[model samples]
Target: MEYQAAPARLSTLDANFEHDFAQRLHWSADTDAAIEQRVADILADVQKRGDAAVLEYTARFDGLQVDGMTALELTQAELKAAFDSLGDEQRDALTAAAQRVRTYHEAQKRASGESWSYRDADGTLLGQKVTPLDRVGIYVPGGKAAYPSSVLMNAIPAHVAGVQEIIMVVPTPRGEKNALVLAAAYVAGVTRGFTIGGAQAVAALAYGTATIPKVDKITGPGNAYVASAKKRVFGTVGIDMIAGPSEILVLADGSTPPDWVAMDLFSQAEHDELAQSILLCPDADYIAAVQREIDRLLPEMPRRAIIAKSLSDRGALILTRDMQEACAISNRIAPEHLEVSSSNPHQWEPLLRHAGAIFLGAYTSESLGDYCAGPNHVLPTSGTARFSSPLGVYDFQKRSSLIEVSEQGAQSLGRIASVLAHGEGLQGHARAAEMRLK
Candidate 1:
């Protein structure tokens, strides 16, 4: 099939630019009502029936029939076997990527995941205690594609955060497992694993089955059903984020090769038909060059059809007034992955404020960050980067405020508390504070 990718061409100077921009950026996160209802049923059944529900759903959804939950579990020895079965090159690459992810998360832990306390003049101590969750479930998407990278990105941070147990769940459709994914689990120190996925796997992790231990949190991206399950079980068990389709916004200054930028855009567009790739450049000629490259290069890609559909549906090649205006628009978009494809990326980086991850310089592609660049690739998608952050050591750990009130400090604190309590007409609260006062 001859694939064509013609992303919407728009200019910042266009009269209806705002309307067109909004339309391009619009992607509703609403899950189908029927899916939501089905997910609820699954979650409730899993909570009520435990292992039996999980097994039944696994068989129905994944076509992997198992008599008992034990058959579904991926034992530690099996994970090791998967790791050892790999060729030297694959094994070496997995190990190297794991090490880099571990190193980056370790540094992140040191920087922010530490306990600290301070004492005031009155001898009152106040601080925070940082502690990791005892157990966490990291879901690896096994459908459509096997993400060994997702395994690394989700599990390494929890391992670095001192999470004691990392339970992994990946669907093995028709009883087939991805060796690379299992190898990643072994390399990332997954404590337990199950070849069960979909809403049932999420329920098993969140509520716990007879065989699957409950997890404090669940992290990783999945399909619509998985996403709906996570959203439903948020209060019961923590989730990473309800991720949307992948996105890449390139802020180019026309200094980088148009082919490189075009391929970079393709890197994201090839993920799925719904994925978006946009380019913002001031030079109209450079934008033309990029489109030409996209035309020439689309046919060579194995996933050319998907790339073509994605670009045609959601992608854009926007012409901004200048680099500064491009940066402003990028902040507005708050893209999941922002690539500053410029000669001096640092010059425009300060002007940029919101992105899940920023890839600086012409050579720094978003794909590098996805696999071996050492930063967590589980990022906030669909403009959630405006307020949210990439997954890190901090996500696996929580903080508790520590307070030690001295006798001297209680006198001052008591009076203030007493006034507020009395003002609120709480006699019990006022008396409690008074009793504490010396």
Candidate 2:
């Protein structure tokens, strides 16, 4: 019934210019050589020992003493019954969210090309074939908080992309999965789960064990250690992204209520102390109003201390001359989530070029996108969106080129192949192609 207080309207406004807000973007690599080496050592142990190493690290890192391997593994029956435990409302919500995510990802499914053959002077057929990854691992963070939504967001797409197996890892301090998480997993149709977490869980997923099978790709979000682990393990195994702390950039022209702006910013801030929320507006008055709103709202919210630190240290308001400058700044930052609360969202949407996800207008808050919205929340952060994209069905699939060379095709293709090989002075390669022609 009650909500965080909105900012009281100010009698006077400061229209001063402050473009200095550009300097705030900073993200440093948190793990050093020693930390990375330590993770590598633990990963080696997991790869060699399998379940024994996983349990050992679980005790050391998560502080949960484990005696055996099966203790951490969830049964299929347990996964099935998890859905019954949830109330009707929660179950219905999970079902709807799953459907929405499925629809969005299904639309993104790209069909595999069919086998084709044609005649060149010598006749050859060459094309690409699309195939899905056989298995993938989804890491869901827990301990401080639980996100059932994460289970839905990560698993359903992999399933839709036709991945054969989905193995999940969630850090459970109490050695138990969240009921909602289990319920979401059930709806998402994930079969196996492991309780062990931290860098060791990543290691197990990357390099299979007697108990835990290796995965082709790993996708999810976690702490700095998790990000660092993902970075190190790339090439050995595929990853979604090395996500930075969550961030949101709200570009408004003071049309929305200060309360709306404050809450949008707070949603990201509450994620972690390092999470950042910025407001870029042409109105300095709106900046002041939102600052007041943040102060009023902080005390009432559950994660008050966390939100306060995040806002003071990472939050900022950049007063721009007009929408043009604001658009430039938004593209420069390339925020994980961009909310265009300007005069016209449709007009501004085209002007923006980079973002993990775009939330147009005040009505489309980032929170909606986090939950029921079809777009993935596992987005590129810390400027990676400039080159990367949000995790989607494609992330769980692989593309292969299809080639069929007849004797005639090989004869014709071999001449060109041999020329390139000979030009590069690879005698063996040139001879191999020439043999097909002979």
Clashes of each: 0, 1
Candidate 2 least-lDDT 10 residues: 5-14
* TM-score top scorer: 1
Cα RMSD, model 2? 4.0
Error (Å) of candidate 1 at residue 110 is: 0.5
* Candidate 2: tens digits of C-alpha lDDT, residues 248-347: 9998989999989998999998898888888888888888888887767777898877777787777777777788778887898899999999667998
Error of 2 at 3 (Å): 17
TM-score of 1: 0.99
RMSD to truth, every model: 0.7, 4.0
Candidate 1, residue 119: Cα displacement in angstroms equals 0.5
TM-score on alpha carbons, each prediction: 0.99, 0.90
